[model samples]
Target: MTEFMFSLSALCRDSRARRGLAAVLLGCVGLVLPLAAAQAERIKDLASFTGVRENQLIGYGLVVGLDGSGDQVRQTPFTQQSLTNMLSQLGVTVPQGTNMQVKNVAAVMVTTRLPAFAQPGQSLDVVVSSMGNAKSLRGGTLLMTPLKGANGQVYALAQGNLLVGGAGASQGGASVQVNQLNGGIVPDGAIVERGVPTTYAQNGMVRLELNTNDFAVAQNVVSALNRRFGGQTATALNGRTIELRAPTDPQGQLAFLSQVENLNVTLPPARARVVINARTGSVVMNRTVMIDEAAIAYGNLSVTISPQQQVSQPTTPFGGGQTVVTNNTQIEMRSDNGSLKRVSTSANLADVVRALNALGATPQDLLSILQNLKSAGALRADLEVI
Candidate 1:
């Protein structure tokens, strides 16, 4: 009996070892799963299906019922012409050569975006902007306007009270205004009269266009889609285009595309780049930006001019010389002493920023320095000035 108990105890020990091994494996997998998921992004965020986009619609219209702050008839004859034409359409015939100087009407341009898959009877928001020299569009109503697409076909009609998000008061040659007065938005102001046919999937295949061009990203997306669906489900046509095989039936195609879009795709590292806004003096760098060892020196030079006005009188009281006005001007110039500073090689954005900041240069100065660095082949990234 003692021999039998010893064998049983050995078996129990082996069972416990197996259980512990299983638990360790599960823990490792649990930790790895989250890390993998964290690196992935939804396909929808990275790409858009072809033939799915908004269409721009624009029209010329008029805004009426202003508080005498509309366009001047003499300055903007278009306003007068538009008003006259609209009145004629309404059966109100005005005598020829009648100088109608109405201060309550203004000509405006209406614009809006016709969203993808929009149908008739859908309400859309429209923006009305003064095409003339209208003082203000507040408390105005947009007349019946036909919004046309690029094809010169009317797709929508806009007519509503302008909801201008601005206020102003002018009196005694002094004026105070907030926000903008020449532009306003009318919510649900336009009704769709026609629909633009959109075909996302053709011949049982849907094309996906990436927001950016990257071969690595495109391949990864193809791989992700294929793995989720089946082999040969997705094929990369180029760095920015991918062909996806979808179902033939409309309902089935939508369902399949939905699943494909939700699939998680691991993205490759972004290309190193620096964007500079020349007008705003803004410099932006991505995390992958790097810099090579270089030496930079910059300085500031300023000049100041002061003018003094004085009245010179004769030494003796009224000694045949009337009071004369004289002017004296002073000019001062200054320049900062520039010093050569060595910038060490940077492997990341933080180090690059630190090295650049050490020069104590302003944004405008930095812009010039970065451009020079790019020209000198020290900046290991593309420099884009916008």
Candidate 2:
């Protein structure tokens, strides 16, 4: 697994291997890997087109063929109205003032993501969600629905049986359920009727938007492109963007993109930063993160409270007898002795973690220790709480 994932890193490394940043994985355990040349990333993975993107389409529809698990019509009047309107369009008219009770039908919303460059007759997956109070959507078939885009134009038609991942059963006021029953998906359910048009800026010049905003990396990309093509072919517009000249013809431009996307360049060292997930007790740090010589005293304090209930009986010599309740509370506190230990600067994350682990610190303890080190100006990285 390591060889497969970091083969690029090994190829980009120097004559002697050195560890890079260690992002926290498996909780506190580090996902330490060699990121030899961070800038060796491919252009295709680093940037996207300026205007080419995906579009979202939504539509309101009905789900049918349920086994007595549909919405209650009286509670959701819109469901009844929608059903009535559909029936009217189909030439089925109920008599005036006729009461309608629908137990095998549910109002639902159908949604799909239309990809860029999608063509007519292309099929896309559709999501079906209950818009009314339905017990479950299991064993339901979604009716034919028209999916519309932001412009209110129908783009696709959807119809399929739902793939519900949940099941439920209820009897005598007792209920049990698994997963979610209010939502389901139909793979390849929507067929595109109309396709949205997209045009790229393939003229003489096009702009590149970096996946991340970094002046050093952007400058490196400009330099690499200029060296490969020509000095006048690439220029940096800002920290996050670069404009490069390309061939006018479609074939030439395609070949140019293929060649430039794989070129590797040495990257400036990443900034010193420590990312801490406050809720999850995970800390990740870059290789540049360092610490100064300092002394730390660590210990733990715990408090436990327990409640005990007792019943008291009173004897009233044949007159009356009564029972009374009494409560007893117990509180206990424990503290571990703290001793000062000297900590020195660490060159890599392995050394940093080893030092911290020697304290026998829990996750919460680790949080306090890092914060205290930051306050003392001993930690030389930006502490980001997330």
Candidate 3:
């Protein structure tokens, strides 16, 4: 046979090899398509249990070692009481009814979070806040204090030199301050004395709760889970939770959870919301917010009222006022160019801001206009005023 005929015979003899190559090509295409469509999610952004939460722990503590920047003794009686208690604990006794003044002590409240599954000896950061009328907490060291949760259980013991991120100096009656004077943080200050019992693997089933409740998101989560561990292993319970069959061993289930927590999920779009801060003049809106056809107008009017008392004395005004006294008043009204301009807004955030600025309206005026628009049903979003 010629060379071409020989090659054709060889190809026909290995039909299974050609079929395997075709199957490999098809598999690659399937993988690439999904990769192009699937979105990436941060591991920290997804899945939390309904009841799993951090516990806040707080306790009254004493801050000492201040550089004459502690609480005033008269204003903060608690500071004196705490100092007295400390002295008594140290085998020192004061005469009854004797007044004692302390300049380096401050009564403070120590706060810290007992993270989930924190075991004994695990150290966490603590926040020390001056509960009394302390001028400042700079250069102060917090004494050992037991931090208790809402259930009145001491979960941790905090004691360390405070790291105040602020500074203040007062010489004479003038003072300069930066940041907060009454609050500070101590890194790794509190050591856990107990562990909170938490369950992750139990009853042969593990449940995963989404941070936000959305039917579409829950469905997508279930699909992702099922795709990873087969359809029979995972199922969605509702719009917020998903149940999965745990592996036979609890340790294995925990390992499975470690894997599951790293799984990526494309988050669903949040609900349309408009947040308005009246005090700071901040307005924020989501992409879903839409505006209907509406006309807006804003203006400013200022009225100045002044009153004067004129004392007239027959050519001796500065000498005597008993001769005659009269009261004079004057008022001036000025409108800030009350020219009305038509304002039309769109769903685009930039466009809405532009329309409001064109009218030269102040932040307060913008706030009023937004409220009026929301009341008139022209703003298609949840209007939240803060």
Q: Rate the local accuracy (lDDT) of all candidates.
A: 0.91, 0.83, 0.79
Measured on C-alpha atoms, candidate 2 has an lDDT of 0.83
CA RMSD per model (angstroms):
12.6, 8.4, 14.8
Candidate 2 per-residue lDDT, tens place, 260-291, comes to 77777567887888888889998888778887
TM-scores of all models? 0.86, 0.76, 0.80
* Ranking 1 against 2 by lDDT, winner: 1
Candidate 2: 10-residue stretch with minimal lDDT: 19-28
RMSD of 3: 14.8
The TM-score, computed over Cα atoms with residue i paired to residue i, of candidate 3 is 0.80
Candidate 2 TM-score, C-alpha based: 0.76
Which regions of candidate 3 fall more than 4 Å away from where they truly are? Answer: 1-43, 303-332, 339-347
Best by TM-score: 1
Task: Give the alpha carbon lDDT tens digit for every residue of 1-386 in model 3.
Answer: 11111244565579786786678669878966785455557433767754456899999999999877788888888778787887898899877776667778899999989988899999999999998877788889999899999989999999999999888777789999999988999899999999888776567777778777789888877777778878667688898888878786868877877777777777565677889998799887875676666776556888999999987667665765466679899999988655545555464555576666765667778788888989999887899998
